[model samples]
Target: MDQLTQIIAVLGVFLYWLILGAVATRIVIKRRSIGVSFSWLLIIYFLPFVGVFAYMLFGELHLGKARSSRSKAMYEPYGKWFSTLYSHNSHQPDKQSDYAASISKLCDSQLNIPSLTSNELELQHTPEQILHAIINDINHAKTTINMEFYIWHPGGLADEVAKALISAANRGVKVNLLLDAAGSRQFFKSEWPKAMKKSDINVVQALIVSPIRMFFRRMDLRLHRKIVVIDNHIGYTGSMNLVDPKYFKQGDGVGEWIDMMVRITGPVVPVINTVSAWDWEVETNERLLPAFPDKAQCTDTSSLVQAIPSGPGMPEEVIHQVLLQSLYQAQKKIVITTPYFVPSEQLLDALVTASLRGVEVNIIIPRRNDSTMVKWASSSFFSELLAANVNIYQFNDGLLHTKSVLIDDEHCLIGTVNMDMRSLWLNFELTLAVDDIKFATKLKGLLQTYMDNSDRLSHDEWQKRPMYRRVIEQVFYLFSPLL
Candidate 1:
């Protein structure tokens, strides 16, 4: 055969083997029960080089062994203490019926947070408030400080925070900073300050991209968790990233970013610490033992808080299951606020089913989302929800990043989990389940503020949107599960 014919034959054989390898890999990965493998396989097959590149660079899962081991070791000492506290405080025989019984039942596990009996919770609304609380907590840290965020810029408020962390580290407090490699790619590339390097501050990036896996994964998976644990006593978790206005600022326009952060002092802190340790260990390969809080010498004022962490590493998708359960258990009302609203089919059905059952179900989303595709996907659900008598509200003022769920004024969950496939399946997310009547009432008040400012969509109005827009939304919805 001529040289040209031999080249053609070689190419044909390579393509055949590639196709076979892809098919076999998909079957084996699916049988092994790896999460989202099928969706990834479809991406790889359809997009070929690009799909494989993205997956290798971004899709490989890291379980944070070092952090998990450290957390297990640290918690071992206080495991008994937590168990005793949970057992003793959980038996609320004298509890009075305050809200809807159905709501109580839906949040029974969240309501019985063992550390809330003596701890106090302060809800910080604005960016300034959150920044101040974080600074104050870092300032007050005596023993150790753990901080993790998806985004950490080097200037503005982030600069201030970096300085604070450096000062804390200089003061002999052990400081560990965990940042998402994708989120803070710029920060990692830029120069590091001498003070930050000299201080015993350990910084590690989650999910570092490797040259070999560059073709298979790139951006589909991320850490997406924001947490701050100080002295193993105080904890902070929310949808906020450690970046400033310039990062998200629209050209010549003020970038408005809205987020809700909660500061909890109770047994929940230890859990938050464990999550941090887990992430740290995954990035640095150093085991972190749990650091138990010193016994309180004074009365604690925080409410009951349970820090529930969920991700692919867990045995099940606890956050998704809990939200679905809450939706099913709703009798009077179901309120949800999330920046990303691309939910699974099951979640969509639950919401529609609840609304059909005469329950008042409402969802709050931003009028203009940062992500064009996600915005289109979210809009795709509007028609179906409106037809089912579900109220849809779009925040007109700013980007709504808060992930909140309020059910019948009795059960409320607020934290880092978004109503999207990533939060449910890929990212390590944290949420606080609050069953306190007072806390729920306060959260409801916050929801009301957003609702007041939001523009509610009527069925007729949603249906009246342009045909082209509707088509785009529908197309996006078809792939929402993979998003």
Candidate 2:
């Protein structure tokens, strides 16, 4: 070889070992769970060049330094204000049931979110109903309307809602709209955003992800929350996105999507507003005030809500811990409904343990999932769950998009959180820990409807599945940490 070729060969050999050493060190020291680390190491060894870059782009939980400093600075004042407001309106923990009180306490202790008691909550069951209610609220909105959603299509009933938003903006209502860059990518590209901006509405596309941005932060970390607040008095949240099911994901061939949303009017609305402000600040670098002061405090024994926001900023898996605790505390029944069910081993064990303890455990998942990987990964765990006598149902009607967990008939957690590791550990999720028998009863009725359209999995039948199919499921489950 020539002089230059010899030098290049030596440098390449040295750099290869250096890169391998550095990656191995980072992966080991980070201790990002054994499964995640193993997956990365496997890819690194097998893919070599592809794996090093992949790990660098999507490995760590880091979210860049500038965003970190901004989040830190923003949390201090928000924490103080939340403490002061929560002290006055929070429901006494002693009054709630053991599990309900524990979950509420966990939310307050971790995120300083208080359990609000004076709220009027209405559950919107259908997509059209949710859109109509939001549009009606926008028409009546006098001061401000804030909306944050993971998905917002610019067609169908969603477009009618957009018209309402534009009309509200035209009427001098301050409309602040924030949509996720990934989920609402098409919405941002559509003329609807341009029209809204032209109408002087504050429109923000949150977490504008890019391949170049991956070097600084985990590119897959998503702002998966769905929130809406009108005049700081009325708020809406749940699994429902701002898209009409008719116009959303139609090609998936999973039938029409089904979802649930809750409309709130009372003390809890401000808390939802506060989190929305935090998200806006994170994306726009513009500071906004906490939830506006509302005097509509109804200290009643009816509707109680504690908003729990979980994501990368948090030190622990707040929702995951809450789920485990709730599972352990179940006295009579447990119900969970989600479109995706790929979960960590701990969650699987918890469900199995609950069933082994004779707690009536019913898990509802979609039969015809939009993603085949999600379907197989979710199915891989059914053998263990079924063996433990945990009842599993596949909702054949459509994609059951409601993410909710009901414990007995007293506590219910409803929001955009899925049972998968993505929602449990990565995505910015919003879940309402509701402690009301009335709401739980209503949710139970809704869940029964889902079960009515579902087929129960038989343990014997599941064991008789084709060997190749079972192997495919195991293959998908191997990457559960990533999924």
Candidate 3:
């Protein structure tokens, strides 16, 4: 009995050292952020076996080699499409200062999509307004209607849109719908897909999650883009999902979500559709041909727009790079509205330095959040931000779910990229970069409305929180890198 006990103890020690050696090597080779590396090191050293399992599951990007190769091949045709499109259009003049212009150019280079001119953009604020615009566009579709969303709940908003899509498909319109397998799981559990199939609408699930499929890809990577293309002439993209804002989830304590969407017309529609097409192709294993815009319908609009898509399959962190560049170029003010605020160290540093350099840095988040852990983790950075003169606002009306940024009234970025680690590193997100004064001014007005509905957090008040709350928040903040 004594010899057996000694042998088991020796094996346990050997396993512990093996896990420690493997984790240490991974941290060094992955070259992740300092915070993330240190956090993993601490967790692995402290915990016995659970930390190693968590690292294997969540600490790495595992989109599989075959999937990654296919994604690269998919971009080849998209590159050619952009090349031809950019050659025909006359380049718009740089209306921005040198700094802002450089930021715009950086996005263009990173996204491989030019800042397209001659596009008209309309901002829709309320859920009713956004759903109405989408349904109206779908009803008028002549050629094709392509829809993709992270969540498509089977409520009134989704049912109304589904009805319109079914009607369109019945009229010989090629209708394609793509929903994230995980996000729309509830919808699929109903008869909505059956109804769509009965109407002959093509439906595909993106990033389907299953126990067997877990061997091929990471379950954390999700398609979070909300996009809709109608007739190859009109498009919609923003933070609004198909679910009703008033009832986002089962027990959303916050009030109805205040979200926004942009209805687009002109040349940028095709560019936006190209992304939807690529997503569909990736999921369905079928190439969707890019829709061509009618020459007669294209006019001389002035808005310069670029679509930036980021995900695990991509080699570069495109949105992260573009956002950092925009922040660095902020001359007057930086106003950001996001539901989540757990930012990367690089992004947090950029906001801090911008505020210290006399730039008005403002961030608006919800007073009531769906995730308690996220809310606590987000508050942990308030001390540093407030010390740097960065003003923080807690939206009192409801959840301020819009993910948008306005920099010096010269650049406006809107879409589904939240200011959190999940949106930055795990999920696939799409953002629109608009460099037009007219649109920026209008967006600024919308942001001011949010400010009117929020209460600014004072530095002293933030620091005076209870001792236990601060300790708990700091503990949650330690897990922000993995959030």
> Candidate 1: where are CA atoms >4 Å away?
2-117, 191-194, 213-219, 252-254, 293-302
Please report how far candidate 2 places residue 121 from its true position, in Å.
1.2
Return the top candidate by lDDT.
2
Weakest 10 consecutive residues, lDDT, candidate 2? 292-301
Clashing pairs in 2: none
**How does model 2 score by TM-score?**
0.96
The per-model lDDT (C-alpha) reads 0.72, 0.86, 0.84
Worst 10 residues of 1 by lDDT: 91-100
User: Per-candidate TM vs. native?
Assistant: 0.84, 0.96, 0.95
Q: Write the per-residue lDDT of candidate 1 for residues 328-416, one digit (tens) a residue.
A: 87889999999999988789999999999999999999888778889888888888889999999989878888889998987788888
| Predicted structure 2: lDDT | 0.86
lDDT, residue 38, model 2:
82
Model 1 quality (TM-score) = 0.84
